[model samples]
Target: MINAQAANPFGEQSKLLETVAAWTLGLLWVLPLLYAIWTAFHPAEFATRFSLTAPLSLQNFVNAWHAAPFPRYFLNTFLLVTMILAAQIVLSTMAAYAFARYQFRGSNLMFMLVLMQLMVMPDILIVENYNTMNLLSLRDTILAIGLPYFASAFGIFLLRQTFKTVPRELDEAATVEGASALQTLWKVYVPLAKPIYLAFGLVSVSTHWNNFLWPLIVTNSVESRPLTVGLQVFSSTDQGVDWSIITAATLMTSAPLLLAFLLFQRQFVQSFMRAGIR
Candidate 1:
């Protein structure tokens, strides 16, 4: 490998170029976050100015906390994500088990329809969803915000693939030991798909946690609003834009996910790798 690389200057140059490009893109992505952190910790007058002598204070965070009903938003967001994750896991697991294990009429067609949902963007269904919510009298509620996402095609597909990789021998043994279908599934399939569940749950939680548009359209009050929508309201001209306070609020809203990813990053990567391999 060393001799081959030594003989290929172009390949070495390409590798170096790729490394530089990756770093450049990473820096670009982190730039806004860096700026937010800087401004959030500094006074408003120093928001646009860079000074080594600048004082760091927690006053901006204090003010941001009080400037909006952030506690309510936080509670709402936590509940929304939890509700969505639980529903997705339960529904997807059952659907995936059926698709992976059962040979039934129209199963392929049904699975294909689910796969098609992966291509159809949720934004395209906004108007229809709103009408549905209004018809069902669930509009402007947390349940309304989560109802559309309960049946996740992605989650179904991921779990289906994972379940299909389980050993048939284990499944048969469980059955022979007097386990019912549901019991076998609970003991065998679900446990084996734990990594995939973790991966899917993480994905679902993060996606809904950052979701803005659907919640904004569905929710009309602070009682139902998630952090993203609440943040938009906080930063709107009606609230008077204070960069310091706004950035502080932004960080607060995002802090949970950031911390979660940072802590479980290893598990996050490993779970997906396992899911992909299976």
Candidate 2:
């Protein structure tokens, strides 16, 4: 009886420690966001100082909205994300279906090379990609930004795992019904893997929306630059640093992803969990 009581106390202590760690990590992540909110709303005079008595104003947002072509930036980002996602879904789905269902010579080896991209992203190959883009004359184009990410190893891997989890009985049934291979995939496997698709899509949207380095490298003109790159123009040496305005711009750039996560917080969490399971 004494040993049982001691073990119970040890388990309780472990749970308490886990709870404390969770709270600590949560606060660490949230503090910067809270600080940014405070800074973004504060006036220029109060930007650097933390003041509870400071009046909140929409003036920073108003100034940021007027100072930059934020609408155009939003549209550009939205379009680029949509374009890349659409292409990725098609290409990755097909690649995943082939990788999951078909047995070809050296297929596993080829898939390994594709998965290697998850370890070394296109960012690490920027110089080579830039040269390729130059050869294709796609510099300063949205396509240049979207092209490299169209075939995503992560997406393929996620979908392949999900597809494999689906019962082979369905495939055999479709085959018995005289459905072709493409029909079996479209009608059978795709619907079953919907959760994985949603998870990958959410991840893709979030990543591409916040992507700066690749966009900055490929785009020079305002016509093709994403919000991250556009925000840089204001903070660059030529323009000089305006702390309040820069914070305001940073908030503007982050708003879409912030709003998206808020709106789909439950689904996003569940999707990530599902993706991890897959």
What would the TM-scores of all predictions be?
Answer: 0.95, 0.93
Each prediction's number of clashing residue pairs: 0, 0
Tens digits of per-residue lDDT for model 1, 12-109: 78999999999999999999999999999999999999999999999999988887899999999999999999999999999999999999999999
Among all windows of 10 consecutive residues in model 1, the one with the lowest summed lDDT is 232-241
Q: After superposing candidate 1, which stretches have Cα over 4 Å from the reference? A: 6-8
Best by the TM-score measure: 1
Candidate 1 TM-score to native: 0.95
RMSD per candidate (Å) reads 1.7, 1.9
Where does candidate 2 have its weakest 10-residue lDDT segment? 233-242
On lDDT, the leading prediction is 1
How far out, in Å, is residue 210 in model 2? 1.1
lDDT of 2 at 125: 88
Candidate 2's C-alpha runs over 4 A off are 1-5, 237-240
